[model samples]
Target: MAFRKFSFLSLVAGGVAQTGLAPKKFNSLPLGAIRPAGWLSDQLNVQMNGLAGHQHEIHLDVSQVNNTDWTGGSGYYSNLEEAGSYWFNAAVPAGILSNNAVFNNLTLNFLNYVIDHQDSTGWLGPEVGTTKPRYLWGRYPFFFGAIQLVEHDPTLADRVVPALHKFVQVANTMLHNNGEGVDDWAATRWEDFVMALQWLYDFHPNGNEALLIDTMKMLKATGDPWEQVFATANFPTKAVDNTPNPFPVLTWHGVNMAEGLKALPSTFRFTHNQSDLARASEGWDNLFKFHGRPSGIFAADEYLAGLEAHRGTELCLVVETMFSGSFLYQVAGDPKYADRVRSFSSVAHSQPLTPRHMWTRQYLQQQNQIAAKNMTPNPFPNDGPYSNVFGLEPNYRWPKFITNSFVVTPDNKSLVQVYLGPFSTSTTLAGNNAVTVTVDTQYPFSDTVKTTVKAAQAFTYLVRIPSWVVGGTIAVNGAKATAVAPSNGLHAVNIAAGTTSLVLNLPAPITTESRPHGAIAIHRGPLNYAFDIPRTQKILARNAAEPRAVDLEFDSSGTWQFAIDPSTLKFVPRTVSALPSPVFDQAKPPFSMTVTACPISWSVAGDTFAAVPPTSPRCTGANTTLTLWPYGATKLRISEFPVMHA
Candidate 1:
């Protein structure tokens, strides 16, 4: 497979000159260039064998692409956003990254069908004909799937590119004429649509440059004022008011907020206004400052809830936030955004939002969850009683599409953006020299990361030293290289031709983060530590309509109200020859920590959720050594615990 090479100007400009900004700091490699290996590979395989692999069989109504309305069929049971388009968006990346033949074929078939059945009027999907009520939001995800497909298999470009251009022309007319297809959802999420357009303009313009740019301008004129909202005092400083109102209030919607993170930065590519880029940073800081949790995500059960231990965050929000962070890192070249991506991917992935088998997942996960049962007066303002229950379709299905890769710098050198689990990449460097870099490490679980680079010619490699690392060191070919302090959190190393071995040893020191009500969360490296409370799972009766799907409820069987002494934290490693296949399993954690804690007088909130940790709570029992495991390993946990002083 040959990868197309574009000039740096074309990579940043989208084939048009910008007014204010220069080229992007880093550019992403084409899809399928990076492959997951080692423990990360095991994780993807587990996902493929579980709910992701068989979602179509289990949830026929939503996942069955052939019978859905997007494919010009009669079945329109689910919303346009969640129908076949959603499944394709989630499955395409999974299939391409894991090289799964079944998933690849499924995506390819859907893409071909949609392209073949496209309406002569240039309207895509089922919302065809002028009389029909058209909503443009669903097409965004559908096109996202199409973009990934064409990137991996460029043969589809001849067909896919033309079809996309035709639709964009229609969209441009619609936006110009009384905002025909723009709804509250579409208006708030124009960022995604803009992203698809930018991709086309940058890679496959095909003489549609003017139309794409015009459509983006019209969308911005009519879309939500995310730039102003982030820059001004209108940004919500607390939980949004969720009263019943006639008008749609999208400011509080969890998923919208996650998508809005990149709205300004994305717009800046076109506007090239420095202020637009600055506001993007402001919005991210404000969101996390008001609603952030110890798990490295903000509170948004259905809306933006305030910083309370028991407030829940939706799984969809978590994944979307990760996506936004990844994009921001590439476009802005900020290390903080890379840190945000690593924290959410590592810590949030460890949370008990999904089961060990990845079969069923919760819509929302609480920071101090003691039970996973239905609540009578549902804690979430907009969600139902079963929002926290583990089920096939708890609320919605959100697929994980984020990947780890080496980013191409403006100077065409390779930059290791984020240090995730084992992964490898093959790409061409400057002068068309082929290179393959493989990273071998049990990272986040272990402090040492060994990278092997095989290149046909000499090139420079830049590694991001995380903001958390203070005494990190790098050795080249078994000898210590002269320490150069990182600039913007990146350390550069010059690599020679042939095979070069690099070892990076980052100190994994125990750290603590202060939480609301004087509680604290422990962290080592990227993994957050939590008290793994004993729990018993009861398999709820299967839904007769969906026999293959299973709903589960977990109840704590042991004490969860314990306050920890952070000073007594001791890292304990399990003596294993190799990391377990399913490394995140609660019963088989790769490592643990022994911490001194005591039973505290913590109470329940309305007997439905754990109450906020008491400020300086009185210890009720003698100190006992408690085992703390990775946050993702625990079914029931106290991630943010009140501090107990001796």
Candidate 2:
């Protein structure tokens, strides 16, 4: 199939004039429109069973905080404040509006508290320092949640719009004076403010809302200069040691990079400057090239730690990268941007091995393989029972919530699949109210997807063909579609009103890639397969303030040092009669696979699996059978291993 380049405006109304390529304009469905179906739905339901999703408990705590004087008051810093931020902005509102009954009323008390208590001037958040308005950073999440609330219930728009205008006026004044320190967190995280303000600018009922966003962008730029930072694109060198900084560099901090990655992309949405787009794309390339792991993210055990197989990525950084990619894909309208989202999504949802308690800790205290500048020395430094304590919420279970599964085409008439999984959705097309779509498949585990569309009238359907899928085929109404071809990572098909079944078969070949230090990473489909090492967990208090806060230490009983026989890298797939409940449970993965391997002489480094396995070491043991599990499903695992040479 031939490809064509088109402008973003073609997708403005969710309608498109196709000239042989997938349309560029695509927007997300309403927060709750397309929901998780099949095993994906089960995973979300399981998450709600824990603190992460216990809507009432989480929101109740949030309401109590909201009712207090901490938000834009004297006692603001008394609590983390973000504990409430995640509940309103992330957890409850999205879940509730998504039609999940579990979140019912969970969003109510919190919304009511904000409505009743928000100062007449539109100030929200704790009032700290002499400045009348506090930090710009804290208010962003509040508005993020408010936007979600307004979408779920439009009546709140009456209150939300005016309140935001007032807040914008106050923020504009602060930036004009350049006197108050309102730029504290906002200086470092100016991109997030851009994200929230842009949403307000796009969706606000008042057409003049763009002015508010203009003021915000102008003011925020003067403070942090993230736009300049991105345009110059200088800071993060290939390795931390290579940078000019003589001390620990806060500039390349993982969370900051994740949040800042979207700076240029978001700015391009307003400026339409081609330079911003180029810099945005260049930023992503540099990040992945120097620091990216097989999981499609760079090593930032809090900061840029260079590319080492075993260096752990902070869960927050992982989540933030996913968020940034979500924005970049829509802004750039490039399938490769969407492809990056899929890569981060798969690793985050399927192989997130980091325990929940350590998520909030700034530094990942894991076994380091390569030693570099500002990194903790290897072989276990003992300093009176060391715990790099950062008293923050662990939020381990929240990664499952870090996804926006579908995007409504810019015309609002069609839909595009972004995060691949079993899902169902309906959009108004040809003036029909009930055009239903049900997508059934165990994606990643199984590449075959069967989408059944039932429409009262005809509508166009666009399904994203991931970059990894080659020689993919589509069968419509049980017949192979010989005439249609998908080249730009998408396939467009027209569906007539009556029941139409589309079966898509994506090639899931067993593949391997060579890694640093003679290591190799294995994959089948979207999942990265790993050796599920047998181990026991030793629990330790995460800190003194919150003794209940704990971290896990694993002691493995099984040997982890092994080399796969590349010629013998066979995959035996199993189809289960039913998916296991609590599917993410480490020992109870929904699917299973077995492979053959040979044990090699391996050594440990930094009291954990060595960074690099011995390259082509002498075979210390006969060929043996080893079971490989999904990387996300294992608590203790070695996903990359040495390729042995006998």
Candidate 3:
């Protein structure tokens, strides 16, 4: 029965409808050259709430984003700054990708956003017009044309590449025209040149040699100090204070740049100049040396603070790193990069993005991401004010901390990492192999990930058994199977020719925990488990002073629940040591913070205060009790406490 169910999963994931037809030459464009359009295209359906053939609805949203008068400097509720053409970039492609009904319209409209704004003096930013960051904005066309027209339209590339080069030169001259240049001379110039090279190389593989030589000479001339440091890695270019304890080592920015250079592998496979490749290699060496964090992250915060908890790590940096890493994977053609890209995007970014798809926090403290309080109170962020974990911020669309917007080509082969969401992938398998994998299962919470592989051939399918999977049963046709082949996370699978059946049953993750602190952050799979306080804004701070005693119990039916705050959860020493919990190792002492007796409560929203509200408002303070639930399941339970003595 399980085998039958898995068979159906693969059939629905369709790919390469025209495999029998002659194949069109794939456009060999550099990854991260202009930001991938196929990545954007694949996400349209999900981002627009399953935009499958729903082209009109997308056009409407795109239109709104393009309407400067309507949007008018952010939304009315929150006085946040607005992107000049927030709608144009988002809407244009959404319409273009939905189908070609308005392709020309969106294409021209997007071009207006790109070309019209550059000044003769060479300045581009949102401040100039709808388009901001001239060089960054310039690369969008490159990405948009990648899937459909990178190679096919020779005339288009001839015109576009040269024009792009001219615009960048003008933009650079504005910044580095003389000795006095922008404060961020190296970072900006590096990005601009890299992007330009990617565009020229994409259009003309044997691109303008004179132009390339001239650009390299320009870089060698003027000769900024950053170039030598980046190219040579003399001593890792760093700003001290990366660790939570502030042991001076590496900064995140340096790590991001290094990763960017690694992206060159995905961008260019064959290069004539060895010097450029050598320069890129040195940057990568420094990337791992100083900035790599224990959490498998490159320490990058706006503050340049080391990899310490409570020190800020910007959400934007995480997205960019993952995006850049994906480019590196494409460039290096290494499975390790793919594995990191797939896992980090899921564990870090995808998990944080809220299901509601609104309001994302700008920063995350790695050590204590599970603080239940709002931390907005105490008129400071470092301290707790609200009951943490289940809180909301407006303007942050979707809690997805990292947006991994790329399609997994499940044609002939596929790879699964962080098995949590519902996915249907279509890919071309070996020698015109058409395979589609439609995985349908309530997993992570469930041990068995019901997977089905529907393909045109009967070939060996390599299913990655996660490290967490200690033991599992593999059933083929209801008869138990003893062995599976090529079990590593990386491998190109070939299903046997002329057979469309492949089913793999995976085991569940086993975990045990012990709590040493007064509070514990619950977790289920990638989601950090939480106590949901469900009430309007009024349900604030009622449980601010309460400490949850860990008492997680799973029922015989496999429904697990944690019974905490034993009615007497106050200034009490933790007695429940044997409970599933997060690792907060005080013995390591890598993180620094002073514990205090500063107890706080949530406001009832009656008065104007400067503190973050509690996680859940108290349903009642008059001898009323509140029950807690998880954050994702917002329909029931009270997360905050009633603040009453037992």
Best by lDDT: 1
Q: What is the TM-score ranking, best to worst?
A: 1, 2, 3
lDDT scores in order: 0.75, 0.59, 0.34
Q: Write the per-residue lDDT of candidate 3 for residues 570-636, one digit (tens) a residue.
A: 2211223221111111111111111111123433222212122233232232232222222223311
Candidate 1 structure lDDT: 0.75
Alpha-carbon RMSD, each predicted model: 5.4, 7.3, 15.4
Clashes of 3: 66
Look at candidate 2 and tell me the lDDT of residue 378.
Answer: 38
> What tens digits encode model 2's per-residue C-alpha lDDT throughout 1-646?
0111233342222333222112225665555566677777776655454334432332334334334343453221222245555556665544663455545455555555555565656556545333553656666666777777676578878977777777777677665555243444556666676667777776773665546555544544444445444443465555564457432244467777777787777666655555666777877777887777766666765567666665556657777787777777777767777777666554554332334322223233222221111223332222112222222333433422223566766666666666667888765653554677888887766767889888777777778887777678889998855533764766888888789999888866678867767877777666667787776655544544334334445567767777877667767666775666555556566545566688887765545436556777767888887787766666556777777685
Model 2 scores a TM of 0.83
> Runs in model 3 with CA error above 4 Å?
1-108, 116-196, 199-206, 209-301, 304-309, 333-421, 427-437, 441-466, 472-488, 511-646
Clashes (backbone N, CA, C under 3 Å), per candidate, total: 2, 15, 66
Ranking by lDDT: 1, 2, 3
Stretches off by above 4 angstroms in model 2 are 1-24, 54-81, 97-104, 128-133, 179-184, 205-207, 223-237, 245-250, 349-392, 396-403, 429-434, 481-484, 541-551, 590-595
